[model samples]
Target chain A: MTVKELIDSGKFEVVNVGAATDTKITDVFCCDLLSIAMSRGIEGAAWVTVMGNINTLAVLSLTDMSCIVLAEGTNLDQAAKAKAIEQKITVLRTDEPEFKAGLYIHGKLG
Target chain B: MSDTITLKYDVSTDDFTRAGEASSDVKRKLKNMNVNPEAVRKVAIAMYEGEINMVIHANGGVITVTIDPDCITMILADKGPGIPDIAKAMQAGYSTAPDNVRDLGFGAGMGLPNMKKYSDDMKIETELGVGTTVTMKVFLAA
Candidate 1:
């Protein structure tokens, strides 16, 4: 599904409608550690994690991630949120637990 | 793109906000050069891990990416406390980064391993209290 569809679906909260909202998301990956996510995230995947930082934005660029979903009620600080906007990487958020968020994204992807 | 193209960037310490700028630029340049997407991904991921290491561990460092038709070479050099045991540090879950860095979602002890994992070749030269230098290469297959 495309990121726009995911955002419009309203399963996840909108943190920022980043620059790449039109990009297609082929899969979903869940991880908090930046390095692991970088190593394991699939191309065009929607990254789900509670880690909100600038490095996360960087990782999104390095990988072909379609978007980032901050789970477990986690949120991005101003600087990180600003960078996410600048990078145009779609970022979503959720107060639901991380597992629940991942499940929802997985269901949507299927 | 038969000729060599070299790019240099100074990675600042504790500036996590801008840590991956150099790697991002390299990725963009490689893509523009029409380098293989897989090769670009490898180079981008490897160099990004190295860049984060520089910010988290070293006071700062220099990243030099040299691109040619056949390969991309990355050199990350830093003047921070070097790794005491390369073998041990290379372990998948080993990390010397402090708690704060861990909170930033790094320091999982995966940087060096991830760098080695994505690149075609990697080498490390380090000395305690002096510094560390990591060299990685990703070959572009014709």
Candidate 2:
């Protein structure tokens, strides 16, 4: 599934979406630690986490993850959002916990 | 024909917000160079962990990446209190980072091990209260 579909499903709120929503997502990976996300993160995966730091953006840029879905009411600061835009990472927001978001993504994609 | 390419970056002191900038830049450069995807991923992870270690343990330092036809070598050097026991520090889940660093989504004690796991070769040269230099290489020829 594409990032567009996840957003259009009305389950998430777009925080800072890149110009193209057609990014093909492979799976959903959830991790709060940037290192775990870096080492185990898969390319084209939608990362669901409470991490809302610039390092998260850096991981998103390096892993080339499809999008970042902030869960558990995580706060995304202005600097983080601005960097996400500059880095071209699609950012989304959700009130649900990370596990719920992960389940939704898993079910939706597969 | 392949040529040697090198890039250097300076890591600052305790700037978690901008910690991975250098790694991200190197990853981009590797992609642009059409490096093998696996090699690129390995290099990215190893370098990123090294960079984070610099900020967390050391006061921050410098990273120099040298890419050649056969390998991508990352050299991370920091001038902070060095590791006293390499064996203990290398153990997974062993961390000396404070609680605050863990709260920032790091200090999981997986940094050094993850760097070693991803890279084909790794060496640690350190002196207590002096500094540390971690040299890691990812094979690009394979």
Candidate 3:
């Protein structure tokens, strides 16, 4: 699904629409550890994690992930939110646990 | 773009939130220079891990990136307590970062391992209570 479709699905709350609103999301991967996420993250996947810090955005930008889904009710701090907007990273939020978020996206991708 | 490009950054511990700025800047520069996407990713990840290490473990440090036609060399030097065991430090899942750092989504013990994994060549020099310097290279060759 494209990012616009995902946003329109209403499954997640929008934090930022990101630079590429129509980029096709290839897959969904869940990991809280930034390093592991960086190494294993798929280029166009949506990352589900509880890491809501500036470094998290940095990892997203570096890894070229299409978007970040803040699961388990996590929210990026002020600095990270600003960074996300500045870097044009799509940021979404879901109150569900990370596993649930990942599964939802997985099912959608299928 | 033929001339070798060298970039230096001073990592500071005064603000933990800005840890990856250096890496992000380098990534942008490499992308502008039209470095291979794979090579740019490698350099970004490896250097980012090193930069975070400097912030969390080493108080702060200096990172010098030299981009030649064939390779991108990153030298991370810090004046902090040195690694006591290189072997253990290199092992995955062994970390010395405190709980506070872990809460920030770091300290998984993957920093050094990730750096080594991404870079084409890696080297480390450390002295107990003195400092540590890690040099990593990512080749731009296809």
Candidate 4:
């Protein structure tokens, strides 16, 4: 599913100004641990997490992730958001919990 | 073609944010060299895990990556409180990292196991109070 669809579903809210709507996601991996995500996540997969930090953007950039969805309405701080913008990573916020967001993305893209 | 490249990076324990810089650089180089995706991913993951271990456990270290047509070898050497039990450390879900490290999204105890899963061969050398060095290799498919 597209980022547009995820936003329209009302479960996820797009909080970041620089989120990439043009990218297509092939799969979704849900994890809070950056190292495990780095090891298991396939490139271009959408990552769903509850953590909001600068390292998240760094990890996303290293893995070439398609986008990042912050679960449970979590939002990034200014510095983190600025880094995301600098890195050109798509960042989204969702009201759904980690499990629900995972299920939503999985049902749509799986 | 005699394509071989060796690169070295010094991991900084002072900067948690820059821990994975070396691994990211290696990933970009391997991708630019047009290595196979699977092989590149394996090398990237293994090296990244080692890098994190260096910063979190060892107070930093040095990483050397040697890439040839046939394989990629990564050596991570660090000066820190070495693991007393290599066998125990290798077990999944065993971590000594503090809560602060976990707050930053690591310390899951999956690093060593994940490194082993990604690489063709992995070896560790350690002394309890001295330090630890981990060497891993990923072979390119013929």
Candidate 5:
């Protein structure tokens, strides 16, 4: 689904829509470990994690992920939020648990 | 892109907020150079891991990236307490980073391994109490 659709679904609140609203998300990857996520992350996927930090945004940018889904109600700190904006990273927020958020995106992808 | 491009960055130990700036800049420059995406990813991940290690363990370091048509070489040199056991440190899930770094979601003992996994070639030269230097290269032809 496109980023706009995910935003419209109300499953996640929009934190930053850096990637165009029409950007397509091909899959979902759930991981909290930054290195593991960087090594294993797939391009065009929506990364689901509770790591709301500047490093997480850096990882997403390096991996070319479509967007970052901050699960479990996690929010980016001030520095991370500023970096996200400056870097133009697409960030989404959800109150659901990490796995649950991944499942939701997975269901939609299928 | 026929001429070699060299970039240098000084990683600061004082802030975790800016840890990945050097790697991020490298990634952007590589992409702009129209380097292979796979190669770019490898260089980015490998260099980023090295950058984080400098911030977490060393008192920061100097990263020099030399990019040519055939390969990208990154040299990360830091003056900090060196790794005592290279063998054990190479193993996955081994980390000496303090608890605070762990809370930052790093220090998982995956840094060196990930750097090795991504780069085409890797080497480490270190001395206890002196420092450590990690050299990694990612070939662009792939």
Candidate 6:
């Protein structure tokens, strides 16, 4: 599904400015453990995480994640968002918990 | 073909924020060197796990990465209290990291296992009163 469709789904909150309207998400990986995510997450998968640290963006870059959706009302720190923007990575925020966000994204992208 | 490249990094103890910098830099360098994506990913994950382990368990350590045409080798050596039991340390959920480290999203006890899972070969050398050195290799993909 396209990032625009995800935004319009009304299931997420856009708390950052890095969302790209035309970006596509092929799969979803929901995890807070950075190592597990790096090992198990497919390249280009949408990352659903509750972490808000700057290192999270660094991990995303290594994994080559397509987009990131922060769950449980967690928002990206300003510096992190800026670095992500510099890297052209899309960032999304949502009030849904990590599991629910994973389910919702799976349902849409499946 | 004498095209081996070596990179070294100093991992600081108890520094959660800078844990993965070395691994990330290596990943970028490998990508630029036209290494296979799968091999790059494996090396990145394995080395990153080791780096985190160094910070969490040992105070800090030295990571030396050697890249050649046939394989990539990572040597992580730390001066922290050595592992009492290599078998138990390799378990997926047996961690010696304190609760505070777990709060940072690590201490999951998957570090050593993940390193072994991703690398083609792994060796552990430790002394109870001294330190530990973990050597992992990922063969270049054919």
Poorest stretch of ten by lDDT in candidate 2 chain A: A12-21
**What local lDDT does model 1 show for residue A7?**
97
lDDT of 1 by residue, B54-91 (tens): 98889889999999888899999999999999999889
Q: Residues B1-142, candidate 5, lDDT per residue (tens digit)?
A: 7999999999998579988889989999999999988899999899999999999999999999999889999999999999999999999999898988877788788999999999999999999999999999998774
* Top DockQ prediction, candidate number: 1
Which of the predicted structures, 1 or 6, would earn the higher lDDT when compared with the native?
A: 1
Q: Please state the Cα-based DockQ of model 1 relative to the true two-chain complex.
A: 0.93
Taking the candidates in order, what DockQ does each have?
0.93, 0.80, 0.83, 0.59, 0.81, 0.57
**Could you tell me how far off, in angstroms, the CA of residue B4 lies in candidate 4 after the best superposition?**
1.6
What is the DockQ ranking, best to worst?
Answer: 1, 3, 5, 2, 4, 6
TM-score for the first chain of model 6? 0.84
lDDT of 3: 0.92
Chain A TM-score for each of the predictions: 0.94, 0.94, 0.96, 0.84, 0.94, 0.84
| Residue B79 lDDT, candidate 6, scale 0-100 | 95
Tens digits of per-residue lDDT, candidate 2, B93-138, equal: 8999999898888888899999999999999999999999999999
Question: Which regions of candidate 5 fall more than 4 Å away from where they truly are?
Answer: none
Worst 10 residues of 6 chain B by lDDT: B99-108
Residue A5 local lDDT, model 2: 89
Model 3 agreement with the true structure over B1-142: per-residue lDDT tens digits? 5799899999997467788889989999999999999999999999999999999989898999999999999999999899999999999999988998898888898999999999999999999999999999998784
Where model 6 places Cα greater than 4 Å from the true spot, the runs are: A3-11, A19-23, A77-88
Worst 10 residues of 3 chain A by lDDT: A16-25
Using lDDT as the measure, the top candidate is 3
Share of reference contacts kept by candidate 2: 0.79
Summarize candidate 4's per-residue lDDT along A1-110 as a digit string, tens digits: 76666666676666664556666777888989887788777677778998788777767767777888998888887778877777667778877887888787888885
lDDT of 6 by residue, B41-113 (tens): 9999999899988988899999999998999999999998999999998998888878877766677788899
Candidate 5 lDDT (Cα, whole model)?
0.90
What total of clashing residue pairs does each candidate reach?
A: 1, 0, 0, 0, 0, 1
Candidate 3 chain B — worst ten consecutive residues by lDDT sum? B13-22
Task: Pull out the clashing pairs in model 5.
Answer: none
Write model 5 residue lDDT over A1-110, tens digit each, in one string: 98788888987898987756688889999999898988989988999999898889888888888899999899898899998888778899999999999999989986
